[model samples]
Target: MADGVRPMLMRLRRNGVHVGVFLLGAWAWAGGLLPGLLEQWDDIAFLGWQHVELVALSGGAAILVGVPLGILFTRPRFRRAGDIALQVLNVGATIPTLAVLALSMGLLGIGNGSAIFALFVASLLPIVANTMAGLRAVPPPLLEAARGMGLSTRHTLFQVELPNSLFVIYTGIRTALAINVGTVPLAFLIGGGGLGELIFTGIALNELGIMLAGAIPTALLAVLVDFIMAQLQFWTIPRGVNPLR
Candidate 1:
């Protein structure tokens, strides 16, 4: 317990420093941060909420679909197909995020639908990949032991395989969410409506304050999301499998 606490404490201290530096930098660059933030407070709040919604919708869908698909891929019946699918997903992941958004916009005809679909595609590969990897990484000895105890396939999967692999699976989720937060800004292009409105608008008008309005919040949001996910990871992952423990 002390061991885990120490690491968490150290991490918090580091995060504190990062927050401080970020604020100091913002203050220096923008000068009188309050006026700028307050100037567009209404837009910032509204757009920020939109940004969160985009991430939640896309990231949630990825987890729901990716986890099951990954589990299916690992099964003997679907292993070959899974391998091919994973290869395809890997190829898909390599395509630029903007291109994915453009493709979705082309198909979905713009709006939140296109943005969500694009973000979902970008977020899926890691979850599926990690789920498969984690399941396969279960030690052979454990399988033999479970079999010796006459555990059924379903029992082995739920009681044994998933528990062991949960840590890796969580890591994948964290990665996917981070990607979602970062990529969400692009959704504005497809009329998805997010913080990107301020950012791009600021750019167009050459207003540092406006750009920082969006950029700063987005950066803070990314950090906050990652932090929340980290806490979830610590609490939910089984202690035996949890590296932090």
Candidate 2:
């Protein structure tokens, strides 16, 4: 009990620190530390909207592609193919995001479309790999029991395998989300609007406050999304399976 409690306490402390830092930064920014940045709040709001839209578009694509591919690969007929597929995905993941973005921009001619495509590719590996791992981890006896009970393959998959694997699957998704949020800023490089617009603009103008104005919001958005996902994970996971809960 003490061991578990210690980690929980530590996590709380870390969260407190994050909140403190965010508040401090907001105070500085609002108090005229950056003479003209406050005036750009409208631009910040618009860019933030773009940032979220890009993440949503790319993340949705990753999930749509990754989950089905993961399921298909796990089938008995495709086990070998699954192995090969995972390796290919691993290679895709290993490629630098900027390189992918650059290549995508060349092919798609820049803008949000290219950015979304690049981010989708970057986010796919984790979802696929995690889904595969989660499904594979299902106990053989549990599957046999389901079969003995005369459950249809489809029913068994949806009711038993998917439920059992959801925790790990969500972990992968959460990871992908984090990656997507962090990567979205790079969209500005390709004329795909995001907080990166402010950041890069700040760099060009040598204004630290302008950069912070962008950076703080981006960081906050990531944290907020991560927290929401964590809650979803907690609620979706079976109580029996969730040791922490």
Candidate 3:
């Protein structure tokens, strides 16, 4: 009981820290602690919207592609190839994100489309890796029992395996989302029109306040999204299935 209580308390403290950082940043922006930031509030808000939109679109794409591929790779016939697939994904992961964006720009031309594509690629590995791990983690006995009950493959996948794997799958998605949020700021390099615009512009003009205006919100947005994902993970995962919970 003490061990469990300690972890719960640690999680609560971590959540408190996330909220506190967000609030502090918000207060600083609203109270004019940074002289130039208030003047660019409209621009900041617009870029924030763009930043979130890019993340959502790219993340959705990653989920759509990654989840199904993960499921497919876990099949008996494809299991042998899964290692090769993961190695290829690891290569993707290891490449610099900016390089991906640059390559995408060459193919797609500059703008949101290229940015979204790059981010989708960047986000895919975690989702796929997590999905494979989660599916594999489903207990062998549970699967045998499903077979004993004469459940169809599709039925067993949907009713037993997927449900049991939800927490792990969500963990992967949460990681991908966090990566997407952090990476969005680089989108401005390709005319992707996100908070990166402000940050890079501030760097060019040597304006600290302008940079802070963009930087603060980007960090806060990442934290906020992560916190929300944590809540979703807690609520969506089945009771007793989430060992940490």
**Per-candidate alpha-carbon RMSD to the true structure:** 4.2, 4.1, 4.5
Q: How displaced is residue 89 in candidate 1, in Å?
A: 1.6
lDDT of 1 by residue, 23-135 (tens): 88787657776687788999999999999999999999999999999999999999999899889988987899999999999999989999999999999989999999999
For model 2, where is the 10-residue window of minimal lDDT? Answer: 29-38
* Top model number, lDDT: 1
For model 3, the local distance difference test gives: 0.91
Tell me how many clashing residue pairs each candidate has: 0, 0, 0
Write out the backbone clash pairs for model 2: none
TM-score of each: 0.89, 0.87, 0.86
Query: Which window of 10 residues has the lowest lDDT sum in candidate 3?
Result: 29-38
How far residue 162's Cα lies from its native spot in candidate 2, in Å, is 0.9
Error of 2 at 165 (Å): 0.9
Regions of candidate 3 where Cα sits further than 4 Å from its true position: 1-35
Range of the 10 consecutive residues with the lowest summed lDDT in candidate 1: 25-34
